[model samples]
Target: MKFIPFYLIFTLLIFVQACGNKQVEENKTQREQVIAVHDEVMPKMGQLKSLEKAALQKAEELQNSETPDQAKIDELKNLASQLNLAYEGMFVWMRQYNTEDGEKTPEEVKVYLDEQLVLVSKVNEDIKAALAKAEVLLKD
Candidate 1:
């Protein structure tokens, strides 16, 4: 019968521990990235509401004008709707997002974080696009 030496067993254990720690660190990094994306756009919620209000008000004024530009009014109204939708999308993401690892394995948590990143990124794009359109419309 062959027996493993104490130093060999100890070295193997250390290697395994190091690998486990590396995986944990990676998962933590991914979680932080997801949170960063969410944070980046969170503060823009108020701006979204303000822009939506301005768009609706401008549309209303155009609607009431004697020589109503129906085309422009329609455009402004559409922009307002887009802004509102984008704002709501953020809330929806927040509601669905779970920060707790719970019983999930590390691989499951990784997959979850990846999905969250994609979802939050989409929300960010929507918000940015709506805001850009609103700014252009309001400027003119």
Candidate 2:
């Protein structure tokens, strides 16, 4: 009877261990997904900066013109500011990312990464929108 209880305990422990491993693996996959989105957009940071610079230059040129198009200048300035904000958000998020190594448990890491994924995705979208607006303005 004593051996039976010990065997049952061993079996339960194994089951629990298996479940924990599965959870850890799932968390790892989720973390990778988040990182994938980040890596995809990281390179675009430089492009966003270039767009900001171009838009600012266009704004400056328009503002300095004797017959300035106030509406167009405002639009360019707004677009440039949006691009800058997006860049800053992405940069700051990267700098503040807290999950690394085994610093956080699997569940904690997953939660943090999932939130960051949402934020980075939004930032990327903002950057793209600003770029498109700047492109149209530059073409004009």
Alpha-carbon lDDT, every model? 0.93, 0.81
Clashing pairs in 2: none
Stretches > 4 Å off in candidate 1: 5-16
Model 2, C-alpha of 137: deviation from truth (Å): 2.2
Q: Give the lDDT of residue 136 in candidate 1.
A: 94
Tens digit of per-residue lDDT, candidate 1, span 1-140: 14568778989999988887787778899989988988998999999999999999999999999999999999999999999999999999999999898998777888999999999999999999999999899996
Candidate 1 residue pairs in backbone clash: none
Residues 12-126, candidate 2: write the lDDT tens digits. 9999899878978887787787777778778888888998898999899999999999998898888888889878978887887665646776667667777877877876677
lDDT of candidate 2 at residue 69, scale 0 to 100? 96
Considering summed lDDT, which 10 consecutive residues are worst modelled in model 2? 97-106
- The 10-residue segment of model 1 with minimum total lDDT is 1-10
lDDT of 2 at 61: 95
lDDT of 1 at 139: 96
